[model samples]
Target chain A: MLTPEHIRDFLDEVKDPEIPVLSLNDLGVITGIEVAEDGFVTVRMTPTFAGCPAMEYMRAEVEQSLKRHGVQAFTVQMSFSEPWNSNKISEKGRKALKEFGLAPPQPYQGILVLDILEYAECPNCHSTNTEMRTPFGPTLCRSMHFCLNCRQLFEQFKPL
Target chain B: MLENAIKDLLYKIADDQLILGHRNSEWTGFGPMLEEDIAFSSMAQDKLGHSLAFYTLLHQMGEGDPDTVAFMRNADQFHNSQLVELPIGEYDFSLIRHFLYDNAEILRFESLSQSTNEEIAKIATKLKGEVRYHVLHANTLVKQLGSATQESISRLQQSLEYALPFALGIFEPSKHEQELIDAGIYSGEAALQNQWLERISAVLEKTHLKLPEIANLQPVYGGRYGQHTEHLQPLLDEMAEVFKIDPTAEW
Candidate 1:
């Protein structure tokens, strides 16, 4: 009696190739998972950023994870039907991002105002006294920030 | 007819992104500062990805594959505006162009997110989120430098004036504009232009820079119908050089 939950558990083993610390499930990119009675498994994913080079690699990881779990006749699709925003990152994912020394995005409602982007809490010292240095960073989903309190320059998982 | 209209719309937008993305890449190691260097490079990567998304949609609609369509097209075959194809001149000009171009782009995607075409809507929704950061970056720099030292302010002002007419070219009307608007696939270019003007004006107002009276300026047009500056063809050649060497070879 394999369920989508079981499939999800298998996917939990797959981590973001870039972040490494965050699992696909906790990243909230595993948009939909279904296991048909005929044993056809369908896994859907959305990219954290449309330009993320790691998406194709992540899709391949999903397929390999499913295969390792002994599942056959599966289709892994990438789409924007559900689109990815920082809010989609699970509480566990936020914890993982913080633990990785990256500031987790603050949850926001409605439109993402510019103020939210200008502000980031320091991951090292837990200080909100930080200024965004640049919106673009080494990767698509990150922004550079400087913390005045701890005098450290860090990256944040940018709030979309 | 509706499909053709949609394809026409996609082509212009895709071409704009691809050309500007390439221009942004030219700044990879040449930026005035290290942070700006990374910023432009990262933005180049993002725009290239965005162009690929639109090209993929066009392929799904029965066009050639993304690489073929992007790499094989000639200057006269492209539908991008004259604004994007211009060389990234000085850093001030590049920054001003970025500020003007991205402001309009954000508004375009915002409207397109509500498009009746489901696929276009979905892609727009996803892209608009990423573009917010671009707009933020542009506005932030424009404000800071626009109000900075005398040399910086004057340089930015001159660039803004030089880039304005060309920026207006971004909204050149499509031949099937009416049809697309009627089909709800797109909001018409005129409406988009008006919104763009208002938005850019608001941002400029925040700075010491003056918004020139664009009402009297002659816009550089015809890029929508494949008319481009002398700069576009060489750019295409350089961009396609490696791809032409071995089109069949796989990475």
Candidate 2:
């Protein structure tokens, strides 16, 4: 019989596909989990959006992670009542993302936020003059920019 | 269609999205599970964004800026169909609303793609991508919930009883409905309604749910006409408090 601690350990290892440095729990995406008396587990998660492309993969990962801990008959439930925001992302997750070569989101204030967006500072060269001619970037999250210094095209996550 | 009439058309479409998006945003963090909470929140945000884009086009046409288009306008100027304004009753009702609106929007964008108005066509091109995802998500829920346990089916049935009339409001014609159709900017309201019903009926059939004998509510035309529901007033009050305080304040 697997313990909840074992379950936690297994889940801790599943990294977010986009930001591989942080676990989903650290991202604050895994909002709730219930371990029933009979070992039936239900995981509650809010996606970044209703139409988020990552949902199927994330759900499967959660199920497989728990099953590895010997929990079966699990259900994954989704809700939109409270809405997910960048605010839900943990400071630790943000730090992890920055450390992993992705820029973490800048905090939101009522006014005067000097957030990244004049040009995405290049990940490779850390140049500030990179500009994206195209709004739709390489991926949904990141836009492709040409580093004037390096002359190499790279991707940066776009602000919402 | 006359430019003014197109502006009214634009307002109806954008307002429906803005109000519905706001209502859906209310569900964030309160869902039965966490993943759904995030998914719903994302959808709400997308709707707000899409509305902003559409309203920006109107602002360029001299109607109002995005913020004013959304928050400052009186309810009578909104012109949103009633479907987008009604309070969400329950999860099933919410799902039903999605089932109706998502597909309708997909069709609306498709029609707009061939619009005579260049700006409208260009905007429709971008919206197609987002609306397609909404259709897929809503359809997936309709199927899953239909095939779900008895409790889910019962709740969905109950949801249908209240939501169908409001859902029908998606087709409530605005003043420019015929002009839009004549100008090849969009299909007429009746045609959209028929297609909406057929699509909605097909999905509901799979859910093993009973369709309520609903009288399509005479849509209260406040959203398109800028005569909004009571809910909208407070919502505007909350969202626009900052912008209202200083029109020059940059968000």
Please tell me which predicted candidate would have the highest DockQ against the true structure: 1
Candidate achieving the largest lDDT = 1
In model 1, where do residues sit more than 4 Å from their true spots?
B248-251
A32-143: candidate 1 lDDT, tens digit per residue? 9988989899999998888889999999999999899889789999888899888989999999999999899989999989899888999999999889999989898999
Instruction: Please write out the lDDT profile of model 2 over residues B86-125, one tens digit for every residue.
Output: 6766777887787878888878877887788888876776
A93-135: candidate 2 lDDT, tens digit per residue = 7778657766554455442122333346666677777665332
Interface RMSD of each: 0.8, 12.4
Model 1 residue pairs with clashes: none
How does each model score on lDDT?
A: 0.92, 0.68
- Candidate 2, residue A138: Cα displacement in angstroms equals 17
- Candidate 1, residue B174: lDDT: 83
Query: lDDT tens digits, residues B150-226, model 1?
Result: 99999999998899999999988888989989988878889999998888888888889999998889988999898
What is candidate 1's CA lDDT for residue B206?
85
Cα distance off (Å), candidate 2, residue B108: 0.8
| CAPRI class of candidate 2 | incorrect
